[model samples]
Target: MNLLLLEDGDFTAADQVRLSGRRLAHMQEIQQVAVGDSLRVGRINGLMGHGEVTALTSSHAELSVQLSTPPPAKLPLTLLLAMPRPKMFRRILQHCATLGVPEIILLNSYRVEKSFWQTPFLQPAVVRENLLLGLEQARDTVLPKVRIEKRFKPFVEDQLPGLINNQLALVAHPGDYPACPRGIDQPLTLAIGPEGGWIPYEVDKLIEAGMQPVQLGERILRVETAVTALLARLY
Candidate 1:
């Protein structure tokens, strides 16, 4: 991971910050940092700066961090994704982070298997790891906030509107109304569905909630592929 991320409090203890477990190994295996080498760093919801590797042992590493400035502004996009299989889910989550999507909501759809909801990757830590990998790739420190919604109608009827306030909302579907708009220059909420795609009823519900159904093409894309394509196209 190129951009090392710490929580706001993780950097508050100015004197010394200890890194253990995966983070420590990341410095060794991924960054290959030596003592006296400085690393690019940022707080989870805050600043970016340099952290000097002052001490290192097999157990942990110590750093002197300076966080006087905030990290780059994240793109204002809320991704509404139908839950995919575990492997595809990991890639999609990481790509969302790397591509700078600020929020991701994994929602349920008819095509989505009920068992997919039971995956351990839904745990906060696993989700964070996938997002961290993306941030590391983009050299971004800010992590995208993730939410899970199991019921489609409740989430769409109750919560989706609040998310799209002051934002353009688009739902990617097959054989829909028109071409997906290109380079939309505003805060956006883009929705992509399962491998088999969103059922007609679900699309109708989203439309009632102020979302426009846009088509990618006649060709159908898998959930993982569609997400990257949609984000790239929208931005």
Candidate 2:
């Protein structure tokens, strides 16, 4: 773990934390942290800081923390993505967090399978777990907000306009449309399709909802690969 992600419950005092389970094992096995050693730490949705190890045991580790640094800045981007399959869902969610996407909309598209929505990964607890893993990987304390939109038309027609307001919006597609812009210093709203890509009807609706179509060249990529690639290019 790049950062020791601490929860509210992990705090035993205002400035001290007690950690067990995976974190404890990670400290003992991977980090091999010793008493008086300082390690990078962050409170969830809070601040980045360092903790000095005060005590350690087989079960738990105690550290005194002082948070003085702010978390990393998030991209001023809202990602709209078709629901990926269960195998790719967790990875994509983690990628979103790692890439500093502040907001995400798990949208529905014509080519998305009905079974994809039924995955256990969509459960609130599971989603949070994956997002946390991403945050830990990126050394970020702020959690990315994930929203679900099971109905495509209503969400696209009713809610998308409000989200796209005054922002640069783009939809990733297969066509030879304008190349995806790079390193722009503007708020962005990007929509990516599913594995087989958005059917024509879905693409048209998204276009009508204010997202301009863009492309990432002729090579097709998986949903997870596309998400990381697009976010990297945009930022």
Report the Cα RMSD per candidate: 2.0, 0.8
| Candidate 2: pairs in clash | none
Q: Clashes in each model (backbone N, CA, C under 3 Å)?
A: 0, 0
Error of 1 at 171 (Å): 0.8
| Tens-digit lDDT string for candidate 1 (17-101) | 7787878888998778999999888766666788999989999888898877766667778889999998889898888888889
lDDT, residue 192, candidate 1: 89
Report the lDDT tens digits of candidate 2 across residue range 1-235: 9999999999999999999998999999999999999999999999989999999999999999999899999999999999999989999999999889999999888888999999999999999999999999999999899999999999999999989995788999999699998998899999999999999998899899999999999999999999999989998
CA shift at 88, candidate 2, in angstroms?
A: 0.6
Judge candidate 2 at residue 193 and give its lDDT.
Answer: 97
Instruction: State which candidate has the highest lDDT.
Output: 2
Q: Tell me the deviation in Å of residue 126 in model 1.
A: 1.6
